[model samples]
Target: MAPYQFIERPTPFNSKGGSTLPIFAVTPAHIETGTIDPIALDWAKKAGYKAESGSLLLIPTEEGHLGGALFGLGTNPSEQPYITGKLARTLPAGDWHIETAPLTANRLSLGFGLGSYRFDRYKSEKSSAPTLMIPRDADGADIKRQLAGVFLARDLINTPTNDMGPNELEAAFRGLAAHYKAEINVVSGDDLRQNFPLVHTVGRASADAPRLLELRWGKKGHRKITLVGKGVCFDTGGLDIKPASSMLLMKKDMGGAANVMGLALMIMDAKLKVDLRVIIPVVENSISANAFRPGDIYRSRKGLTVQIDNTDAEGRLILADALAYADEDAPDLLIDMATLTGAARVALGPDLPPFFTDDVELAQDLTEASLETDDPLWRLPLYGGYEKDIRAKFADITNAPAGGMAGAITAALFLKRFVSNTTSWAHFDIYGWAPSERPHSPGGGEAQAIRALYHHIRQSVR
Candidate 1:
């Protein structure tokens, strides 16, 4: 929560509002046609501004008063949808408007608000960025709601493991449920072991007991939608352990839970006509005397025995139970998201997450939504050939395969075994953390696929 403010139906220039500036986004074409303001043109020439990407210039009148400013869009302005986000940090702490551009007011304002985000929760002091006063035509409220969800996810993800353990994660989940007036049920510790053995096995070592968190909202008879998230709050790799470098960002192991919370926020805020259920198995994969060993075998909630070939692959174990639970009711749509495998990151890198789903229509809708929202997702085949890879002689299945080939696919295949009843179920292997900065996103905890998924849901609801 910075000093930024979004005003609806903005008023024109007036003496009452001090130091308000007008921003004109310019492309190479605009420069060639002599369409820009004469004052700004003169300033650009004097300042050697080429209207290249990220270029900004302010014009001064004869009386030394601020005239207007120019922003560069390079070859295609639409490509950099959130380029205007820079205006919030670049311009002085005051009101500014996009005078002309190929972009919509909603996009411009949304970018500004998103760019202004800072996870200074632990910081001593926070800086005040310039406020972006949006136009009346812009969908300010909707954008605000979406960003709120993203920020909520980011805040939860960024918190260190010490403070964001299983109990704290349940608190965050409960907070969201309370805000939306949803009913919440939590089965924790020993009860989890009895009902969700896979979830309990993965989290048995941690002092913060493992919990199966469920929140339900909307009418019972409405189109049913169930969301399952892998809430590994902090993964220390259990008995197998991890290298120091690999453990650094393990706080984001619960990214799947964070993302689901974000998507749930978007759904509940919009009052979408659907019964929504969120299932998160909040746990921390820590090491101790009680930690589940890699070779340990345990019976899962779905009545299938699992041999833990790798304790590091515990995310899928917890999700297996949650997914099985979700499948029992056979909802209209079921989605499970998790930072399940580094193989996914190796294949698609950090920004482009991979999703697995058998439904052709669902995949097509999600693909279009990805393009529409600029939240990219690649469809990876759930090859039945790899199904044998997860099969184990000792148990019904193994959490990890022996060959270590096609890890993402094998993980998806393993999860697929538990989801027999759901008509439409998709699995998302998300990085959950942005490796670097983007136009609208900072480099911390990133909300992946939710925007695109929201678009897909919107279409489905309509």
Candidate 2:
């Protein structure tokens, strides 16, 4: 499938022929200080343009031709850093350049590119996007690389389960690995049963066999950064089953995998001097006569028996095995992203996912990066008091705890049990779906936390 059409890097702006339109990112203060053109300022007073956040006004020349535009930054531009995203959808299709802004060029350009994304792979008609001449001060390649990663993730998650099943998802994974020239391997069928028993169990009932997909890149002796993602392609909630409304968006169950792929792309594209590894447990949680039951106990890859208290909780099951495998390597940094629980959304909502980590420095770095990248994330405590909730009476542990209190934390603790070897490890419980349209992001399968992770990882390694 073709990639999403994003903002372009245009030739350097020259005012000789008036070919390009200038866009001023103005705050309320700028408007009051008469910082804008006198003609545009006079028009603004007549038109009642207060320069509110995300508001746009087109400036016309004396000849009645489109001359320029003003994008409002409001009084507190920092409060809405990516407010320029509105321009991507509101601007007329034309060559434009940012003449002035309160924020960095990278921030404005990335926001525009992000808002320009459209998943029209299945549409009959294509949409046209306005072009932006990347600012001279911006890192054009960096912006493009991040945009590609985000778009790749959104595309994968937005695909319907019929076209995004285990097989198709693996193909996409392989395609990415091939593009980056990374070594790839898969363990499936009977092999998966022995190597990743929990993964095989969760994915066994689907028509497509479940598998463990692994990719390795960069030199072996460098700072090792291993990523694990939950890849339940289409979750029917297994034998437990979900209400029709709940299952409608289950196709995004594999959003965790999509996000990790995005982060991996950014890491490889920048050629960060660090050893990178990705482990994804790809599966479709379906129901059948032979489907793993709520009472069934299966041995995990870590040799721990897990009782299926609720088959609906399958993401953490597959992630348990993958995390164990990743932990065995004892990478310098181990990170796992999963759309594992609705409780995460309950706690922090879909926009700000909660992450759990024991490492103080990792938490601080991720917090700083989250703010810097505008990829919001909140750190939740791995409370030891809740450890008893995951304990099983008949087995080593239970996949789902009763009462449903602090569900997200318990799920993280369950996965944390298998990650004993890794010193710096963090788990993100992401909703992965945007409930409604927001500035710079459309409502669909969304990329959460990866940008922050990418920023933190890149800075730490460098």
TM-score of each: 0.94, 0.95
| Clashing pairs in model 1, backbone N/Cα/C closer than 3 A | none
Question: Residue by residue across 1-462, what tens digits does model 1's lDDT show?
Answer: 222111122221123233567788888777777688777777777887778876778777789977778888788877888887676667665566677776787777777776766777678997756665566688767887778777777877888877787877888888889988999999999888788999888888889899999999999888899999999989888888899999999999999999999999999999999999999998889888888997789998899999989899999999999999999999999999999998998999998999999998888989999998877899999999888899887999999898878999999999998999987999999999988877677679988999889878877888
| Residue 323 lDDT, candidate 2, scale 0-100 | 94
Superposing all C-alpha atoms, what RMSD in Å does each candidate have to the true structure?
A: 3.7, 2.7
Q: Name the top lDDT candidate.
A: 2
TM-score of 1: 0.94
The 0-to-1 C-alpha lDDT of every candidate, in the order given, reads 0.84, 0.88
* lDDT per residue (tens digit) for residues 43-104 in model 2: 77778889998999999888999988988988898887777778888988877888888989
